[model samples]
Target: MFLAFGFVMMLAGFHAESDEEHKVAANTAMVLSGVYAVLILLVYFAQATAVRLDSLGDEALRIIDYKRLGLFFSYDLLGYGVMSLATFFIGLTINAKSRSDKWLKGLLMVHGAFFIGCFLTPMLGVFNSKQSGVDWIGTLILEVWCCYFLPICILSYLHFANKSNK
Candidate 1:
């Protein structure tokens, strides 16, 4: 999924042809999106292969400490922050040739704002007190973000598909 997201961002970057400024913006977006992909892949690898959550007790595992918001969780959130920034930069490439493009660009930029919360929430110790509590709120927010993001992803694909058809 992260690879597909990165490729779409690269396509969006390459699609912008208005000016040198746009090209630079697109390049930046492409690089950031690539970074997002790599970061996420690492997060997945660390969780799935590097550490086995079932094998370790809550007190013993620092890597898979989802309950207390552990290392892998931080990496996951950080990867998402990178993804948000990539979206923001990719949003910059949108020239808004049509209403759909305009919507896509707007949603991407707004989604980028998620980086702030995703990056800072753990640092602020907001979830520290709830170590023993179920992180239903965080889970809900992520689901809501996915709901908001799916349309943007679909519109982005359509934008590129229409461009390719032409």
Candidate 2:
């Protein structure tokens, strides 16, 4: 969840370095990043607090339960979708003069495509696990996400660190 906050800061840094032609896209990224952060924060906080209600009926509990692919899970996925949009815009704002920056830019743009799954997953109700509270598909998706993002993060770190040196 803290990734939401860091994602905003990452967008901010991108905005800070953006050229005049890219500022509009960078600004859009920043706004979307904020929305992403708020949505995720609300979902997580509710999971930590409100969803813990002792008096909730079984049906209501099912809706709020973090264990199931319920309403809150939908909201969480939506939040990530918004984050994907933010990163897409961030990618648009990059000029990508270096190879690292070029890879970062491409990765950010590709990452945005995750929004499609995030959108359709809830509506289609396609993902399921054989065991309760153990979503293997979700786990697989997350593993894929982490694997894809590793290069992006590494490239971004190198890009900024090299920038600071110059």
Task: Highest lDDT: give the candidate number.
Answer: 2
Error of 1 at 144 (Å): 1.6
Candidate 1 structure quality by residue, lDDT tens digits, 11-92: 5544465367677767777777777777778777666764664576665465565555676677677777877877887788
Candidate 2 per-residue lDDT over residues 1-166, each given as its tens digit: 7887887887888899999998999999999999999999998887777656557777876777656667877888888888888889899988888888999999999899988888888888764433565655556666887898789778888988988999
TM-score of every model?
Answer: 0.82, 0.87
Off by over 4 Å in 2: 51-57, 128-134
Error of 1 at 104 (Å): 0.4
Candidate 2 contains a number of clashing pairs equal to 0
Supply the TM-score for candidate 2: 0.87
